[model samples]
Target: MSKDFLEHKAFVELFDLHYGNLVGFVYGYVRDEEVAKDIVHDTFLTFWNNRKRLDLSYSAKSYLFTLAQNYALNYLRHLRVVEVNEREVSQLLEAASDELAEYDERYARVEEKLAQLPDKQREVFLKCVVEEKKYQEVADELDVSINTIKKHMSRALKFLRDELQGESILLFILSNR
Candidate 1:
């Protein structure tokens, strides 16, 4: 009960007597041997640092048990937080993977439809849309009138729009919603 009870030699004796039991007590709460040992060590460190403030009315064994219990509970609470965050991050990764797959499928379908276009219409569409060329520039390159280039682009767009109208439209709307 005196300050000498918490001195180095007495503290070492206390640790030797209680360390295994404290680890077992903490393991009952935390369920991991390494974590239990760590918590027990931390408990003793806390006890040593706060030796002067300890309530002399309580036995050191009871005080050490209380500290170990608190440390174990805090570790469990932190582990739960980490598990919840890991689950959330896993779900987010799954959703992003699904979105990426969907985007790749949509891109492939658009590519297939582009390949289905007539040669002249496909050429005009690529030049105007993909290459960002003006109608007059495409017409001059192809040696055609600007009106002819316009008609080709218009037909190509209509064909692609009609081809992609049904499931693609529904998916777009549903995904946005």
Candidate 2:
């Protein structure tokens, strides 16, 4: 229609023609396709906004390349912060997983020690230590004499204490239980 409208349309066409190439160029620096696309999009938006002030004598391609470069640098700087944050998060997650694995190993060792006990002793120990039963209650439930329950409990504690004594940490864990 009008000269101004035609000029604007031509500018828009030029942007579309170079958009892919600009994105690819920025991607070379940024090493990320999405960031490259974003930088290129911002560059075009900035160019469009400054269209009226553009110097027609200067090459449009050169102007676009400069804009793309500046945008890519800014994107890279922003990515540095994101990268640091991601590394910190990964480290924290690894530490948490390591702690959980240690706890699981300790629990497994305690289970293994329990398995080593005589069947009657193991049952009595579980009822007293794990089930939190009193000696008289455990004796009534198991239909054993109170003295027999006490003897089983004494043997279970002695076996666990001796097996875990070398590892003070395990002793603390067992004592707390």
Candidate 3:
């Protein structure tokens, strides 16, 4: 076998040996299984990219844990931003309740429909609408591709449209509002 192939095999073995502990380490910080998995995946990506320069003397476990910790911290910062944005939108909606009653009712219905979506789609939709985050930002924060965000948003709109057909005018007003 070629030297490169041998090295790659070794890397795979090392990754398999470390993956579970790395995921546990990440979960300790992030407290979410999906997010922890993503962080561990990213750590592997980083390790692969830096393979030629990697210091074999340093424990692979240590490096993976450090990467996971950094990623988790960044994720927490993104969550804080999303929380602040949600609060701002909630305040705006509250302030305009009298003028936007019909619109708000339609929006409430749409939101109820949204809640039925799979978790990821619902999260993307809420981040886009209630938090006013751009699709790219939402995708990055969710560790999903931009195309996934678009698909989620498109499905969300379709669901809302179907559910709110009789209330078209109210829906349009709410969309604008």
Candidate 1 segments exceeding 4 Å error: 1-6, 166-177
What tens-digit string does per-residue lDDT give for candidate 3 at 38-84?
98899899988898898979887788778778998898899999999
**Which lDDT values do the candidates have, in the order given?**
0.87, 0.87, 0.82
Top candidate, metric TM-score: 1
Q: What is the lDDT of residue 123 in candidate 2?
A: 91
Work out the TM-score per prediction: 0.84, 0.64, 0.52
Compared with the true structure, what per-residue lDDT tens digits does model 1 show for residues 27-115?
99999999999999999999989988888698999999999999989989999999999999999999999998997787778778889
lDDT agreement of model 1 with the native? 0.87
Error of 2 at 171 (Å): 8.4
Report the Cα lDDT for candidate 3.
0.82
State how far residue 115 of model 1 sits from its true place (Å): 0.5
Candidate 2 regions exceeding 4 Å error are: 2-7, 13-28, 31-38, 46-67, 166-177
Off by over 4 Å in 3: 98-177
